[model samples]
Target: MFSIVGGHPALDLANTVAPRPPGAVEEEYLPDPEALVRWARLAGVIEADEPAEPSAAALADVLALRALIDPVLAGQQLDVLLRRWAAAIERSRLIPGPHGSATLHLGTDPALVIGDRLANALIDLVRNADLSRLRTCPLADGGCGWLFLDRSRNNSRRWCSMDDCGTHAKSRRLTERRRSRR
Candidate 1:
């Protein structure tokens, strides 16, 4: 999903973002502004040597916030689109993970739980900001879903992986040509 990440560091400190898999448990949370204000307080939760499951009451508020990403699923994951990075680094590449789940961490240890924590922070970023000017991303998390990021240029950047989409589109064209010749 297109995650948005930008703000004046109040509740926008989404330092560790993570990619969600299809079957991953929902953390029993949704995400809401009011609850985010409260949820952000739990930033320390992920930081704990062994954090507890976020308060059930808080988890209820979080999960009730925005459980799905919209039309394709539930709703436009407003936070997903807004949870992007501020760095202008071009061409993001995938990093290997220990469990065979490719990961892209904003930190030295990609598998660390903090990455997910950072992503949650970015979620709060979008949840609290004005999104009238954000640009829509077609695919991210390897086509898991869509996301929205603030584009400084007029160019449209959808998926995070150009290698896959760019290369696959070309491959499809070649295959179609071979089949047509038969």
Candidate 2:
């Protein structure tokens, strides 16, 4: 199962590996090409009619892209991110959308489609989004290092999800306060 907590598809891809505290084993949701296709569909990177089978190499590339983008999301690796973005752009095409707007059409190879879309989305975020609004769930605060765009009115969001990491952190704080009183 996948959690679509990240507002952007690229962030969601980065989050495919669940956040774990230090010394905890990482949980990877996309373990194979089939899992990647399923995730791409859930993330809206691939259409219902699009080809679903991806070559093994494409799956590796998608995994590699996920690795490359996660660091960039955390405010590191800009030059490397740019190179990957350029590569994605080179493989993509411009296509017409519903309201006469053009959309980037990442081709049919399932993993490549997801990879290219994620790359484009990351660049779009970099170019248009307020980088200050970007944040990582704090591992010490019961977060799993997932990245998210803080779209709150005051941009005060801290956890990946109010229902998940936020709840955990809040509960921990309450428990700590109770223990301190005892």
Question: Tens digit of lDDT per residue, candidate 1, span 1-182?
Answer: 21223222222232112223332433322343344434444444233254333345544433332333322123365544344222211223468878887865332322323334444444544466445543322323223222344444655555433464435555766888999999
Model 2 poorest 10 in a row by lDDT: 17-26
Question: How accurate locally is residue 92 in candidate 1, as Cα lDDT from 0 to 100?
Answer: 38
Which one wins on lDDT?
2
Which regions of candidate 2 fall more than 4 Å away from where they truly are?
Answer: 20-25, 70-83, 95-104
Alpha carbon lDDT of each predicted model:
0.38, 0.77
Query: In every candidate, how many clashes are there?
Result: 28, 0
Candidate 2 lDDT over residue span 63-160, tens digit each:
77777774675678888778877877787788888889997666634446767777778788778877678788898767888878888998788888
Q: What lDDT score is found at residue 154 in candidate 1? A: 53
Among all candidates shown, the one with the greatest TM-score: 2
